[model samples]
Target: MEQASEMGEIGREARHEGGKDEEFRVQPKWRKFLAHVGPGALVAIGFLDPSNLETDMQAGADYKYQLLWVILVGMVFALLIQTLAANLGVKTGKHLAELCREEYPRFVNICLWIIAELAVISDDIPEVLGTAFAFNILLKIPVWAGVILTVFSTLLLLGVQRFGARKLEFIIAAFMFTMAACFFGELSYLRPSAGEVVKGMFVPRLQGKGAAANAIALFGAIITPYNLFLHSALVLSRKTPRSVKSIRAACRYFLIECSLAFVVAFLINVAVVVVAGSICNAGNLSPDDANTCSDLTLQSTPLLLRNVLGRSSSVVYAVALLASGQSTTISCTFAGQVIMQGFLDMRMKNWVRNLITRVIAIAPSLIVSVVSGPSGAGKLIIFSSMVLSFELPFALIPLLKFCNSSKKVGPLKESIYTVVIAWMLSFALIVVNTYFLVWTYVDWLVHNHLPKYANALVSIVVFALMAAYLVFVVYLTFRRDAVATYVPVSERAQAQAEDGTGAQAVAAAAAADHPAPFRKDLADASM
Candidate 1:
């Protein structure tokens, strides 16, 4: 009886310990999720950058809330494309840049590097202008002086990464929230019709003049090119284990975190549009405010919030714009580093690299600001947006091809539904961009100040380049992935090991003919 009683006690202890174990398991699931949160936050900042603000403000001031649907669609597509990048990193232990280097020849790689660098520089133009405009608004500095100041300010922000990527993410995220709070606070005051905002977000319409162009710009701002390289490389910083369950779990957690981050970004974008729409279209709008709305730019966005924030409007708007511009500058710098390191296998200190890109980006901005002042600077932002739109296909085509490659991701290739959706969205983007480019070029040709001979020569060169662009995109789309970087050896070995099969034999066979190494470290590994 004593032995029986002891056994019952033992059973009770076992049950209690089991309960504790279950609780422990459930608790760390969330903790593990927290570990995956920083990368998505970093990527989501790209969505709320100054470029996005420029497009959002224009869309709202010009068409009220009619273009909110564009933001929704663009963000949905951005989420899909970004997750594919993360999946590529997690599954292959390599970022998109590294993969591109391995897959392309030396000449092709050089061309791609130049194209990506141009994309980086073009992206920085708006950040430079937007941040400068913020400084001018707040400190009452000349726009040209403010443009020069942007060169030094971003270097200080980049210093945060010295602590760690997570710390930098925290800093960027804080800036993002600051911008959100400022806009949403203004939004509450304006109180645009909730029904109209809902309809604008769900129902797609491009009724008014220039609405189509604004929609294109809005879409381009949201889906940035450098963001793909940044997201893919950022995932490598997490050090996920090389196991099926761990990889799958990491991908799932990253997606959820990314979705949440985008939701915050989307709301912030909506608030910007709604506030601009509400104030610009108000019956009580002053003539000066009406004139500003008739031609809204970042420099004048503060006027929209004048009645709401009163004398503090410029200060509040400048603060939000500064956060928007500076946060994106930091993100752009990080992306430039990743692009250089990934494609050219070249690495530099963050400040040095940032200074180089910033200097290049500053020249055009300074010239426009000094020559034509704030209006010219605003037009430069739109020009930069168009450049980004044109550059998107180069980065995107390769990513789509890589993600759909069975050899590149082995058993982790994207699903049929995902593939179909990705292609459809991509095709739409390419068509819109091509049509716009051709239309703009023809429009310029028809109304140009150039000599006819010079116009003829320019037209030939431009058409040739456009043709080359389309051909290259077609090549990448149909290109066969000749290399297998992420084989199914790990999965196969784990399965076979349970039945006494040797894992080494499987790894050996998988690695035998592989040109690229199976494991790639972000710091030292070369493709």
Candidate 2:
């Protein structure tokens, strides 16, 4: 342990001095195993985004215990997929975005980056709006003021990462645990029927029109495109030794860590639903809550908590909401950095990136907040999800392809069965999400949901935006980059036995024997 520590310090100082003082040697034993613990915490908090609160709240309110299964499915897959990402990152020195850039072509890379940036901006919009809503409810601050405040608050958090990624993880993890405690306390107080909770979790049923949408929202929150990119890249922050045994151990522990995170996320979801359901399902809902029951917003939830769960519960709920939004902001900033660096190979200071992203995100947020303060938060969430829906194919399609590729991901390659099933599922999800987005946008375009008749000018502008969005989707589905050809391992083995890399003369040769195919396949690779 002392040797590894000394070696790390030596390596750092030597690098700092431009190799002038080379003293440290490579590690005798890799410390990569220690890195698996932090990335899961980051990914876990991804589930707690404010958008998720709405979905979880809806799930519990409408169905009571029936949709606990959403959380179950979410956690199960989050662990399964994130471990794959962590394993890939630890095995390969590069992060997922870097791999994508190395794997795909220029135009394709830029397209993906644009999509990811949009998703990040979309994700940030909610955090901005949610913070505003919380400010409005608790402090009676104007929503516009809250928006400005959130950007500054997040800018301050940008400094926290200066110490290290693990520092950011610990801070975020503490907040997540605090959120869990608050909800778990609520769950205990509510004492929701255990049998019903179990039944809801195990049995999958969509009873109302809202059921399907709520289920979709829950699934969308759990398996987000940004989180996938975020997880893969985050695993690369720590240096892990690349060896068979150590890689395998890292993979195993990551699985455990991710599974645990997912389960905790599940309980939090259950708590949200339980809290909402208890109030909505109460024998005596007040007329105002009952009247607005069909359309609950962030503003509605705390009041419900205060009435049903007590004023203390309301305080806990708001505090947790603040923690949830802030922790999510931490990751949103980190993910933005990875996307920018991976796609562009440009490194900016954390604060610069945070300021740049928050500035862009805050404008649309400010306009919406000022024009439609408290009520607009819900629209902001739906719009964010819609943006995520549009960006889904960019991230999801690449991950599916890369995970299944033998040459790129190696023995860690997803099984043929896993590939087929995962691809089918991913394609179905993208289609469904896209369909919803298109429908929503189209409905807005045609009806103009504003009071009185539609303004032709506004409708025309919306049409243009929606058309551009559709064009982007069509490009993703139909676009083809230069596909890299792969020589099978068996063929490579036969070649090696014959004359590949002049096998007898070369002590280590696979890296040399490998073709330039990964370079050829590079167009679609950016994260």
Per TM-score, the best of the predicted structures is 1
TM-score of 2: 0.77
TM-score of each: 0.87, 0.77
Candidate 1's displacement at residue 312, Å, is: 1.9
Task: Give lDDT tens digits, candidate 2, residues 183-221.
Answer: 666667767677877888888787865566677767766
Off by over 4 Å in 2: 1-35, 62-67, 160-172, 194-196, 291-294, 304-309, 437-527
Give one digit per residue, the lDDT tens place, for model 1 in 228-272: 998898887774644455668789999999999899888989898
Looking at model 2, report the run of 10 residues with the lowest lDDT sum: 17-26
- Model 1 residue 31 distance off true place after TM-score fit, in angstroms: 1.7
Report, for every candidate in turn, its global Cα lDDT versus the true structure.
Answer: 0.79, 0.65
